[model samples]
Target: MLKHDYKVRTGNNQYEGFLVDLIKEVANMLNFQYDIYLVHDGKFGSKKADGNWNGMIGELISGNATLALGLLSITSQREEAVDFTKPFMIRYITVLMKVTKSTTSYFEFLNPLHPFVWFCTIGALLFVIIVLYVLERIGNINRTDYPSISFKECFWFVFGSLLHGSTDASPSTLSGRILTASWWFFALILILSYTANLTAFLSVKTINTPIKTVTDLASQTRIKYGTVKSSGTSGFLKNTDIEHFAKMWAQMSEIEPSSMVDTSEVGFKKVKEGNYAFIWDTTVNKYKTIEDCDLMEIGPPFDPQGLGISVPTGATYTEEFSMAILKLNDTGRISEMERKWWVHRNCPDYSNPSTDKTSGLQIENVAGVFFILVGGVAIAAVLCLGDYIAKRILKSVKKEKVHAISPEGDDI
Candidate 1:
């Protein structure tokens, strides 16, 4: 109820907001004068230890006000003390948090895979390299065509093949070739998975948020969170039969300074200060996100309930007020009023973003990695040609010496 639906005090003690406008429209239709005021105790109303109601509900129960015009949630408990008109708005609880920018350092390119995944991949590569090297040595012992491979050459051969590049360390024996073929298959699959995943990381701007649902928040303790003290959210947590909400209540109860705050703005301020999340209505959270780019709604809305104009129980005018609201809705006046107050204003261009296409990875995005592969292939080819040339020169030199010698004397 502390959302923008509350009356905003202005000069001459007048008030404005969605609530103020709503009351005005109701008055014009019913042809009655209504004076707007805020509740003295500044509460949404909850049963205290002494067993008496307080806040706007108390104001109505004590005959201090006729109709509660703010965003009062209609509940069975509140209904016992006060009556509600047909709901003018529907809302639900949600989490609000500071917009933490994901890190964009040069090394962020490594984020496509988790640290554990990378560890396992490197371990597999190392294990395969040792197996291939041992197989080559075994082939040599059997007097096969396989040449003895040094650890340095093995490293280049494995890493270069993993990148889909040529290397001078090609195996000749059947066992060595089979082992190399298996590694090639593994490398192909790993490459395809990495490329498919990396496209999302490189193409779209994404927020690296770990908490995406109430279950996530309930499971974690590093981020402190709480609802407005005596709020419907607090009451819901206390009364909910769900286990996840129960755990959240226990955490909020033991938190330092009591995570329960007095107002939505105060709870929002905690979020702005960092490391704190405000549990409140999504309607209010959405409005705040629009005004401040640093704020965002983390999870989907839950516990849907209607926001209605509240009245004291057995009030004579209850039916009339409900009818007036119904008429306003039918005529689209309510929708018009919502757009008048809810549309984005003064928020910068980036605040209202369009659904732009997420482009795929361009050649320039990975040109450097391609160049590395090309350079390795070039060097390996050159070394292979040099070995072949050196062998041919040695063979020809021996032939020339033999031919130059006389047939009988064998002297050059």
Candidate 2:
């Protein structure tokens, strides 16, 4: 709309916006009182195929209104019908889109870790399983009467360690024992990391980039786009020779249930319902989005044109009104009025917001698990060293006793 509800019927026909305020200033400057009325058709203007103009332009040409205001766009076609004051505001056409909540997938179990992460985990498991199997076979060769564990047995043993925290039987060789210990520590950390992230990791995902421009909309079929009917936005799209925009216009014309809407509010409603994009004036789109965190405008606005006051051609006050607008711009009164009308932001920017709480798990959340694992591994390594030392000392004592004995009967 020219304002969200650009012209509101507040208090039996009172209207507001910076536009309303601006006109008041103009009225005061020119020392002329004015009464504002809505164009009965409620359109800015569009030229019909028969060359008849409608909306505010008709009001101006037919002398039904002395001065037409509020979102009356200055166009070449409209210029021929009514004289336009200097453009007080610039309206850019842009896309308004609603972000849909992501649906949980059926294969959400794999969502906890990315695919690359899962692949690496499997790779690590296979590597450890193969190493354990090969080491056991080599040990069997060294001790000729022993039998090595099978590949299947090695896999189940390693997998059991990952799931249940440990295997009942471990390899006999020292190298294989060390590998098993390392795998156990890894399993502990991985389990902790996965559990810590399980709930948070499965939330939302962005499947595609947001449609920020007309070309982005044109390139995709998933989201339907449209603008208000018979407004400058539609006229621009319909009249332009640009390929992508032309495609968009063609779709709007031919699409079922009709993409064109009666009002900006309807366009915005479709966007909210889902898979719809509303292309309209940036200012109105921005106004809607500013107060509702769920709604948003995405752009570098296109097809920027001026919103100007309209009067019949050869009107005496046209120059006076343009100069008044220039005065307001120079004095920054227009800006002041704009801020006053849009009001303060009622909703925070969802895309980039300031918050007191962190939303999801980070490495910091699982770092303590890794620390516990490292400590456990270090203690195990030290205990293994102590055990090896104790074995060697016992072996040395037995050898000395055997060497000192005379005829194996008396102690030395």
Give per-model CA RMSD.
8.9, 11.5
- For model 1, how does the per-residue alpha-carbon lDDT over 1-412 read when each residue is reduced to its tens digit? 2345335744314665677778888999999997676777678888788878989988888889897766578899898889999988898888888866544444445667899989999998899888888888877786644567877788889889998888887766678789889899999998888888887777875545656666788889889899888878888888898999888988997754468788877898899999898989877787777778777776667889999999888989999999999999999999998887767645322222342335566565566566767988999999999999999999999998889989896676
- Please tell me which predicted candidate would have the highest lDDT against the true structure: 1
Cα lDDT for residue 314, candidate 2: 94
Alpha carbon RMSD to native, model 2: 11.5
Candidate 2 residue-wise lDDT, 263-309, digit = tens: 77788889889788898887788887876767767776788789898
For model 1, name the residue pairs that clash.
Answer: none
- Best candidate according to TM-score: 2
Worst lDDT run of 10 residues, candidate 1, spans 347-356
Q: What TM-score goes with each of the models?
A: 0.62, 0.67
lDDT of each: 0.80, 0.77
